[model samples]
Target: MNGLNTTALVLLIIGGINWLLVGLFQFDLVAALFGGQDGIIARIIYVIVGICALYAFTFIPAVKRRHAVE
Candidate 1:
């Protein structure tokens, strides 16, 4: 559970940064490295990141637990 949460968090951060780059500079880092939006690798990365964001949603319970501890 800990590992999954950590992985999800990392992926989520990556996705967030990617979005920031897009919004600020009109650049798509993931697509650029992987070869554009239609590229196979880029699509896979988008899917993986999307899944990670969804998975991270489950961490809300863990977050509550941590805050409760404090």
Candidate 2:
């Protein structure tokens, strides 16, 4: 993938891992690293990740098309 896709995928992975940590151990890596959930930096990161998730949905049709070709 290109740079934007790679960045989005990485952020998605980070978000996924954060969710896993929250599910299993009640931890939030991003908040802990940046500050608490209410911290400005943490909130910015959360917003970016959410935006990336929406961007990722745009890939679904391409993925389906690729799979259908195969």
Give the best candidate by TM-score.
Answer: 2
lDDT comparing candidate 2 with the true structure: 0.97
- Residue 66, candidate 1: alpha-carbon lDDT: 98
* Predicted candidate 1 versus true structure: per-residue lDDT over 1-70, tens digit per residue: 5787778888889999999999999999999999999999999999999999888778789789999999
Tens digits of per-residue lDDT for model 2, 22-65:
99999999999999999999999999999999999989998999
**How does candidate 1 fare on TM-score?**
0.89
After superposing candidate 1 on the true structure, give the runs of residues whose Cα lies further than 4 Å from its correct spot: none
TM-score for each predicted model, relative to the true structure: 0.89, 0.96
Q: Which portions of model 2 show Cα errors greater than 4 Å?
A: none
